[model samples]
Target chain A: MKELIEKYREIGFKLTPQRLAILRFLKGNTSHPTAENIYRQIKEVYPTVSFATVYNTLQALVDRGEVTEVTIDSQKRHFDPYPKPHHHIICIECNKIGDVFKDYSDALKLPKNILKEFKPVRNHINFYGICRECQKIGGIKYGNMSKSRAGCREF
Target chain B: MKELIEKYREIGFKLTPQRLAILRFLKGNTSHPTAENIYRQIKEVYPTVSFATVYNTLQALVDRGEVTEVTIDSQKRHFDPYPKPHHHIICIECNKIGDVFKDYSDALKLPKNILKEFKPVRNHINFYGICRECQKIGGIKYGNMSKSRAGCREF
Candidate 1:
């Protein structure tokens, strides 16, 4: 933990008590938490924590490569601590994100035509699936369903 | 277009004017527009357009497998008229998303362990790169950089 603190200090992070609390919470977390998730967890310990502080600190960490944002869920941004390169698998039914550590860089070659227009940097693959729990529960709403059922009933 | 209407109606859609307008807008659109983007466009032709209407239409379309939600951006959901199964390439500098029509499914087999826990449904790959325009401009911020400038400056 000392090295983590020193690393942030070297990077000029203010490391306020709240920030420290956030760092502690995210240190080895693997849940792929959202901003609100982080705020709620931190609030349990620091009741006075503001959402802005959580957002700012999260943004700072993300900017410094300490956290990686998982774009698997369109509804909210999920943050993962940056340990190494990885991808994600999301449960379509429950929205649970699981880590995929195997690297597929060798197989992700871009088509020559697209390569001409854009110089490729990196890639992330989102594998959508039915988690065991969701499968067991027969969950089929697929959360993105529009709130109105005005005349649609097939789903 | 008549066939499209018949398709949705067969599945029990109401075929309201606003819903039809949104459907026509998305019939073959490839730009991967967000809800707000669609809302603005529809509002021009239908002054009475409501966000709820747009969102509801989108949700209904998504639920019925008529539209695919592109989860490439974390900020908001972008919808693609469910043309076919495909992938995407995003310009890191400008955040412009492009479609990749090729399929890589044959090579994306999951490791045995994960496959056992979750049944894979589909996969979408997001290729990050610098678009031609951004390259001409010497590239703007990559946007994912952690806020620290301590030892990381190469992004």
Candidate 2:
């Protein structure tokens, strides 16, 4: 926590008590919480905390490349504190997101035409699937098994 | 045009004149326009067309899996008329999105733990890059060239 405070201080980010609380929440967080998610959690401790405070702090972090804005969810934007290149798979039914640490840069070659048009920087893969809980809740037993098996076969 | 009308009709989509016009504009369009983009274009023709009509038609098509709602651009949702599995590379500077039609399913093997937890169905790669035009406009010549060259070296 001291290192975090010092790091943000070195970066010249003002450390309000509320902002500190937010930084604490985001430290090593892997759940990929949204603005509202962070706001609700922080509001419990700081009852007077406004949503704008949380949103603006997050935006500041994203601008500095300290946090990555995950856009896999269509309804809302989720934030990841880790900005390092990685992948994410989202559960289509429950909207749950899981991190994928594997790298596939070698296999994701852009076509020659695209290579000529754009200078590619980084790539992220968004995988969509149904979680086991959702599959059970939706009573999709044998149907999903065959589909997932076929998907595995393709790999 | 006739085939598009027939296809939507065969799938039981109500073909209002406004909806038909929207369909005509979307057919074979690779631009990946947003709803507002479509609305603006449609408004030039049908001044009386409400935004709700365009939005609702899109929602219906999305519900039926005829259209894919692209959430890459955080500002607004872009719609892709083609529902076939594919990828996209977006220009970070201008937010211009381009299509990538290659299949990387084999390369994206999920971790054993994630595979166990989720029944994977499909995947899409979101590549971030700077287009040639943006690189020139931003005066970011040699800097991005090295970064992109380094990126390509990884592949």
lDDT of 2 by residue, A1-155 (tens): 89989999999899999999999898878778889889999999999999999999999998789999888765577889875678988777556678888888988899988898789999988888987677766744442332353222211
Chain A TM-score by candidate, in order: 0.86, 0.85
Question: Where's the lowest-lDDT run of ten residues in candidate 2 chain B?
Answer: B146-155
For candidate 1, the docking band is: medium
True contacts kept of 2: 0.83
The per-candidate TM-score of the B chain, in the order shown, comes to 0.87, 0.85
lDDT of 1 by residue, A1-155 (tens): 88878989999998788998899998877777788988998999999999999999989988888888888767678888757888888776666667787788888888888998889999999998877766776745644432332222211
Model 2, residue B20: displacement in angstroms?
0.6
Q: Native-vs-model 1 lDDT?
A: 0.80
lDDT of 1 by residue, B1-155 (tens): 89978998999999998998998999878778889988999999999989999999999988888899888778778889958998998876667777888888877888887887778999999999877767776734645533332222222
DockQ of each candidate's interface versus the true one? 0.66, 0.66
Worst 10 residues of 1 chain A by lDDT: A146-155
Q: Which pairs of residues collide in model 2? A: none
Per-model tally of clashing residue pairs: 6, 0
Report how far residue A20 has shifted in candidate 2, in Å. 0.7
